[model samples]
Target: MFDLVYNTIFFASYSNFYGLGNITLGLFDVILAYIVTIIVSILVALVLKVPLLPSKPYRYSFDVSAIYPTPIIAIGILSIFLVLNYTFMYNGIVLAVVIGILSALFVKYLFDFVFPKPLDADEGEDM
Candidate 1:
């Protein structure tokens, strides 16, 4: 049941974009698409006014911000498509861009809700 729904969505998405699978695409192109997704996601996040880095004491901060989480999300999603052999139009260029944009927006708006900040910070509880 799970595989049926998974294949239906992933394969249907690729077929709609006329994806011919990785046969027509080289490893380099696939790699480039992942890189593009990362770059575009970061760029969009920056444009959305996300800080380039976390706040002071960055090492311990639990904050989720653009430069870090945005690209991470984009590449992760792109990897899913790659692993599923579901490259979309333009050798995944279009898919990468879409992923990048959506990831940035998600990080900017929805990440906090998904991963709420630690509320006991002032209590100095070791994490």
Candidate 2:
């Protein structure tokens, strides 16, 4: 029934990476890794005194905040590691946390140098 079809299609595709008897982490491990990433990101941002939200209006703000870039960057990096089959073992969780903290630091410090704002075209103009 459904198991037969699923095994045929899903395993066929998955076998390329996982192989016939490869050990893999469960869903809980994946979820826990993501949770670690998120929590570490926010905590690091708060410790560094990143604000709770963007300073300028949401539409035109590049500021990093406790609730914004921290979690987003953490999740993004975690997703990449997950796709590469890395999980929450052998200090993988610590690595994710470090990455999350580093990303927040980069956003706070080096982002402007890496992605500077464009000059205003109407500067020094009269109304």
Candidate 3:
């Protein structure tokens, strides 16, 4: 009984079975890609001097920073690539690093231009 349960659960957990061709990625590899992308993005953002956190009391602030958008951008882009089956290297470590670097740069330089903040005067009117 225990063996039956274990084998059933293991069926869908691997990229391929003993005699079948590989299709989906192993769970560990996809998770590793996400983790690496997030770490690299945060590190690059810190090195670039993007603020580590949002503005003070920023429950509603529009400010983009290292912790807020850097990882998010990196993970989001990585997801798109993964969905398209475009991991540039086996296990996707290289793709993760490249996405992380580009995301940090985009947040540091192009973010404000692409997503301009509203006028400060009325920013907190609702509060």
Candidate 4:
């Protein structure tokens, strides 16, 4: 469900002349988009709060699989746009911001999945 929303926003933004010809947008517009996406992702994480892994005392196991989805999705989508146009002429700042937001959201979801509360734990339990 979250993936759908995230991908939809990404596709919609890209469809709006994302990596086409030399189009220029204001800095503030780019910044606003980044901020909005980041905030939305954070809110989603807070609301879900699903721990993906168990917390341990000074012992750790990392789930690397959880770390790569969003960037892969973003890069794959951007690569398609760039390949289709044969140019990387989109707004750099905007792209960076978008990628950052996507990356953050992806990581948040990853952590939630990787560090989830124990099975015996009740809802609202803190780790």
Query: What C-alpha lDDT values do all the predictions have?
Result: 0.77, 0.67, 0.79, 0.43
Cα lDDT of candidate 3 equals 0.79
The pairs that clash in candidate 2 are none
Runs with alpha carbons beyond 4 Å of true place in candidate 1: 1-22, 121-127
Q: Which stretches of model 4 miss by more than 4 angstroms?
A: 1-23, 51-127
Lowest summed-lDDT stretch of 10 residues in model 4?
A: 61-70
Give the per-residue lDDT of model 4 (tens digit) for 1-127. Answer: 4353344345545555545333433445444444544444444434445233434432443332222333444444444433233222344335544554555566665545765635433455556
Alpha-carbon deviation at 9 in model 4, angstroms: 18
Task: Tell me which of candidates 1 and 2 scores higher on TM-score.
Answer: 1
Tens-digit per-residue lDDT, 1-127, candidate 1 = 4353344345534554454444455555766787889889988998988888988799988776777888988877887776576766887899999999999999989999998888674689666
Poorly placed runs, candidate 2 (over 4 Å): 1-21, 88-91, 124-127
If both were scored by lDDT, which would come out higher, candidate 3 or candidate 4?
3
- Listed per candidate, the RMSD to the true structure in angstroms reads 6.9, 6.7, 7.4, 11.6
Whose lDDT is greatest here? 3
TM-score of each: 0.76, 0.68, 0.76, 0.31
Candidate 3 on 55-103: residue-level lDDT in tens? 8888987888889989998988887676555667776789999999999
The better candidate by lDDT, 1 or 4, is 1
